[model samples]
Target: MKNLIKINSKINENGSIDFKELNIDDFKEFDYYRIVNPITKEIFYNDNGKLKLIHNCHCYDIWGNNKSCDYCVSTNALVTNSTKKKLEQIDGNLFLARVFPIIFDDKTYVLELFQDIGDSYVKTENENLQLSQIVTQLNLLASKDSFSGLFSHGFMYNKIMEITRDNIMPVALLCMDIDNMKYINDNFGHYEGDVLIKKISDELIKLNSDNVFAARTGGDEFQVIFINYTKEMALDYSKPILDNLEKILIKDNYYASTSWAIEDRIKNQNAKELIESADSKMYKVKDIHHKN
Candidate 1:
């Protein structure tokens, strides 16, 4: 999903996008156009993730779906407050999907646009150009995660290796995970659990400053790499997230118990070793918290 259209110069506080002035004919090049309410998450779908049609759109004609797509990009864009652009393969046909967040009618929504680009691009580009484009596409695929605005795990691993191999100075790694996530999902429902996860991710985003890279490595696990940071400094930085998250409670227990381990970059340490050491420390902290 890419920023395919500049629909509005700025989104207002009420979350309304005014496209009344734009000519719809100019957007005829797009294959599909739809709007989604992100805050409601009340798309035309069953509570159990089934697609159910509630709005009139070209979805039925394009994909034969009366309901929201299972892998809706709007859902993710709202969670991350970021634009989502990607190539999607729908029923063997390829499409370029672009999901953009828009404020409309005092509510947060998303504009979803797609174009069928299956074989057209391949046939249009020359052989040499296609090869170069494929390489660039592969690089992007390895760099960013699809679901949220976080660095990909593979890219994070490469960063760790580069820092350790070069013996970079003033580098530290913090590994953190949400506590009792399964319990939350089971009891509070997955929808609410997803909201909780988004909240946690948002908190982590707040801590993303200069040289601090954050990534989601596991189901409920997050890894942070800090350039020019120490264990104590990392803890100090994470304190705000901890404080902010403490207010969320579940069944009298905190919604999430976060444990992070900070490890310094050393010549002897590799990415795997650093992760292991950090995991051990994080588990110890989590254990103590659970016991208390």
Candidate 2:
């Protein structure tokens, strides 16, 4: 039955299943269906037979996990070229997922059909609110850096990739690293070093807005992404941050300082290249600071 359905289904040029054209109602048994890129975890909802890609959303979002599932049936179906099933439990709700691999435009994708299997129970308003709060807290713990209260490196990387791939233009990448961090940690106590880092992070947090995303990428490294801003505007925005850092006194004589570089998005540049460009320029600034 599955083989006959697969042979009859028409694949559109955009790699979506032409459900209306095929007039196949075999999928009506499933409560909901989604097509997913097994490798990237990119999700697409099947809308009346056409697949519509969901932006900045992954399969993991539903599971509330920081990473991919250990035993992902979608990827497994893609590998084995057969149907697979997994029973998943999320927030006390049970769901059964049927995964099957399909090929379109020479690319393989997984079709996941999900059905709720948990005991039917109506929840009170308070229960729904509690579930919402739990999910929000879980997401925050997954995406936020513990110490700095900023977005984590993994979150930043995924966000940048989403922005770039979606062609959300006029974005700027600003990479910054603390100056003489090793020296500070060695000469001053590590406690003082921690204090300095916190101070810098506090300043970065103040810069966060709807269009600006700041993240603590490493021990002494940070990244601030400015969306819908040109190079000059991003520079103007960052100037006050630099000024604020200059005012942060770690000790009586020494002040906190950072070397930063900003790179505006260019045509055909991926997220990694944009970050590396700013990172390379930041090192040059750091060299000049060292010499001075």
Candidate 3:
């Protein structure tokens, strides 16, 4: 179908749409459409509950409610000023819903799209299924540490960037380093050292939850990001991890004295700064531990 593509959206221009506002006709391509003011839950970007744009396609009934869905991620995207996507089920059909913020008439608006995706992965052949499994395995391997099954440094950094860019507020980072791993490896053997590393990875992995992403950022070093966290909570989390590692026997007269650094996100918009801040704190603690 040919589209009535606009030469320009004229979002911020002087000669914009009538009254510098928008209507349902602005987004005519979608199955169902609405230009929303997230703060007011109305159509169009306005201070009051005034709808500037509202239109529905024939399939609107399949979506259930006439108003916006409850617990919408659109609200989150609006708050964070970022784009968010989610897969939702409605009337036995699956849809990939996207929410993004846009500027219009010098105000903020929420643009939403719901794409149908109910039958995108139905393959009948066994070979095709095996090939799909291989692709999935490859993707997982790319993001994981082969030895410990924890997230690799590269993938962890990528996730940190994603988290920082997203609307996850009150985030905290914890960087940890194992004590004297080289000594353990040199005297006891690399095998025993590997066992200790695996033990640390296992304990760290056990702390995983909906709000945390844990990764092995370096040899004898691990990092975890806690969403909606505080300094006190991060310390509370550290105690359990140290207690768990205390149960493992590294060697006679030898014990693990791990050091950690925790930092909350405040005025930092990049992952490198956040990780470095935590890392610097960890080193200070490690240096003191070594001296004593």
Estimate the TM-score of every prediction.
Answer: 0.51, 0.62, 0.54
List where candidate 3 sits over 4 angstroms from the true fold. 1-134, 246-248
Error of 2 at 111 (Å): 18
- For model 2, give the RMSD to the true fold: 11.2
lDDT of 2 by residue, 89-151 (tens): 455555567778876556778877766665533266676556556545555565667899987
Tell me, by lDDT, which candidate is best.
2
The weakest ten consecutive residues by lDDT in model 3 span: 1-10
Compared with the true structure, what per-residue lDDT tens digits does model 3 show for residues 1-292?
0111122222334523342445434433333334555544455322243433433322223345574332345555665566766554444444566668777647777666555565444344664455445544554565566788787665566556656765547778989888778888998899988998898998888777877778887778899888777767866976787677644577886776687778887765577788888899989998987787
Query: What's the TM for model 3?
Result: 0.54
Alpha carbon lDDT of residue 132, candidate 3? 46
Q: How are the candidates ranked when ordered by TM-score, highest leading?
A: 2, 3, 1
> Which pairs clash inside model 2?
none
